[model samples]
Target: MKATLIQQIEDICNTRGVRLTPQRKRVYELICNSPKASSAYELLDSLRETEPSAKPPTIYRALDFLMEQGFIHRVESTNSYVSCNSCHDKKHFSHLLICDQCGSVIELQDSDLIALLAEHAKQHNFAIHNHVIESHGTCPSCKK
Candidate 1:
């Protein structure tokens, strides 16, 4: 999974004319290998193992680039980041379902839900640009 994700990131960067610097690639790899969303500080600490000089700014810069290139997603509620599963696909809005027990996140793209939200916004004369919905609950694994 990590290898495939890295290859996809490389392909997407090449297609989008985005530069995947060594630091950015490493940061992305760290996120991909993570079992759940990771905080910037967590990334910095891990990076420092190999890159002793790595600082918060270094990690943040790489994260900014990765987010801009659609290689990752930020969970606003948790203030952490996750590797985007839809990086190689067309841009679309997605909500996150977080497992409170395990901190796992499932990205969901529901057309009906999106459309309903859009319609609701339109009723109030608001133009929808982007949105992030986060719902927390126990996952199936944790429920068992």
Candidate 2:
């Protein structure tokens, strides 16, 4: 699954005529392999295992590149990153359902919700380049 997703991302980057540098790919792999959202420092630390000179800026730059390409999602409330399941194209919309107890994240795509938000934005004369809705609640396993 991880390999497949990475290949898909590589293809997307190629289609966009952007270079997914080795460091960026590593950072992306870290985030993709993680079960939960990962903070910048955590990613840096992990990256340091292989790249002893890896710095915070290194992770940030890689993350910035990935985010710009819309291959990853940033959890706003917690300030972490996650690559949710299903990666066929550059993710344009992110509606996340977060588990407050287990720290799990589920990314959802709802066209109706997107339209709703767009309508609200239009009413207020707001031009949204991109948006994410982070809704926190307990998961079924956590509820148990």
Candidate 3:
């Protein structure tokens, strides 16, 4: 799955005419290979294992590019990031179900919910731009 995801990201970058630098690719790989969200420091630590000269700015820059390309998402609540599984699909509003017990994150997309939110925003004459919804709870596995 990790290899496939890397391939998918490479394809996306190629199709979008985006440059996938080695640093950016490594950052993306670290995020995708992780079982849960990873912090900037975690990514930097991993990068340093190979590239000792890596700095916080290096990781941040890579992360910024990955986010801009929609390859990964930042979990604002946790100040961490997760690889986007729907990157190959059309862009849409997504909500994150965060497992407080296990630190797992599940991404969900509901057109109906998005529509409802849009309607509510419209009622207040607010133009929707970007949003992040994160819910924290115990995951099914953690419940057991």
Candidate 4:
């Protein structure tokens, strides 16, 4: 939980005129602090440890807001979510490297690749919305 990131997200919310409610804040904090991507049920269970009244809708709403704000990315393959540290910087397409053994995620951005893909999509008449490239392998620690 870096104070800078929290401040940046707070600033983004303030600038966007969106309220970062306590529930949303807590859920995101959990996601950001996690060593690996987490499932919604895991988040809900962890959140419930403190907020006994927390429910599925609460987690869903937080996830929605987080995604909309681009502060987090959903790992499509494993049905999990990871915090995007650079998302507060800008909006761009990125590929993810997932550690199959540890479930840790690393995000990689390639503007040239994104441009090429966009061009290819245009050629194929495919309108891209959400894009996530998940490549799974062992991470450095897991390679041991």
Candidate 5:
């Protein structure tokens, strides 16, 4: 399953006329392996230890490409990026559940909410292109 995701990312990058370099692969692998969303700085620190020659700009560029290709989703509230499990085309939407106390992030599927949001957008005469909802609160672990 993981390998398939990597291959999909590589295919998407190729379609976008971008080559998937080793550094980008490493960064993508790290994001996929991590259980939580990660910031570029966190990735940079880890990458530096593993590949001392890697620079911050390289990681940032890779991140930008990954984001543009919809290989990852960025959480505005947390200011971090998580690997997008559903990567096929650029026409998908996602909702983010973020824990305020522990900074834990979870992806939720709310079909009803999505429908309502779509209706609301239509009523307001707005063309919905990209949609991201971030709900912040304490997770069960933090509540305990």
Candidate 6:
């Protein structure tokens, strides 16, 4: 699983023509391994264990690159980031399933749902440059 995620990250960087530096690769690994949304601070803390030399700006720059490449999504409500499961297309954004209790986040890829939301916006004469659906509730584990 880790290998696949790393490959995906490399593929993304290659497809987008972005250079994947070592630091970027490390940050990518951290995001890919996490099951929930993570903040830069959290990632930095974790990276410190394995890479004590990694600095805050290094993680931040790597995160910026990932986000720009559509490899990750930032959850505004919780101020965290999660790898996007949506196909890495510039036109797609993953709908976020957020667990309020534990701050867990799940990425849902629903093309039909996205179309419906777009149609709804058209009905209201609103032009959506970009948008993400976020639903907050307790996840199964949190409920238990």
Best by TM-score: 3
Best by lDDT: 3
Clashing pairs in 1: none
Residue-level lDDT of model 3, residues 15-118, one tens digit each, is 99989999999999899888899999999999999999999999999999988888888999999999887888635578999999778999998889999999
Q: What is the C-alpha RMSD of each candidate to the true structure, in Å?
A: 1.3, 1.6, 1.1, 1.4, 2.1, 1.8
State the lDDT of candidate 4 residue by residue for 26-140, as single tens digits.
8888998899999999999999999999889989999999988889999999999998967666466789999999999999988888999999999999999858788999999
lDDT of 5 at 130: 78
lDDT of 6 by residue, 1-144 (tens): 778867877887788788988887888788888878899999999999988988999788988887887778889888888877753574576778899888889888887988898899899999988886789999999988
Query: What are the lDDT figures for the candidates, one per model?
Result: 0.89, 0.88, 0.91, 0.90, 0.82, 0.83
- Residue 18, candidate 6: Cα error in Å is 1.2
Candidate 6 vs. truth: CA RMSD? 1.8
Q: How well is each residue in 1-144 modelled by candidate 2, as lDDT tens digits? A: 889888988998888899999999999999988878899999999999999999899999999998878788889999999985555556578789999888889998888999999999999999998777989999888999
Ten-residue stretch with the least lDDT total in model 6: 85-94
Give candidate 4's total backbone clashes. 0
For residue 34, model 6's alpha carbon misses the true position, in angstroms, by: 1.9
The superposed Cα distance between candidate 6 and the true structure at residue 91, in angstroms, equals 4.2
On lDDT, the stronger of 1 and 3 is 3
Candidate scoring better on lDDT of 1 and 6? 1
Which of 1 and 2 is ahead in lDDT?
1
lDDT of 3: 0.91
* lDDT for position 102 in model 1: 84
Cα-lDDT of candidate 2: 0.88
Q: Estimate each model's TM-score.
A: 0.94, 0.91, 0.95, 0.93, 0.84, 0.88
State which candidate, 1 or 6, has the greater TM-score. Answer: 1
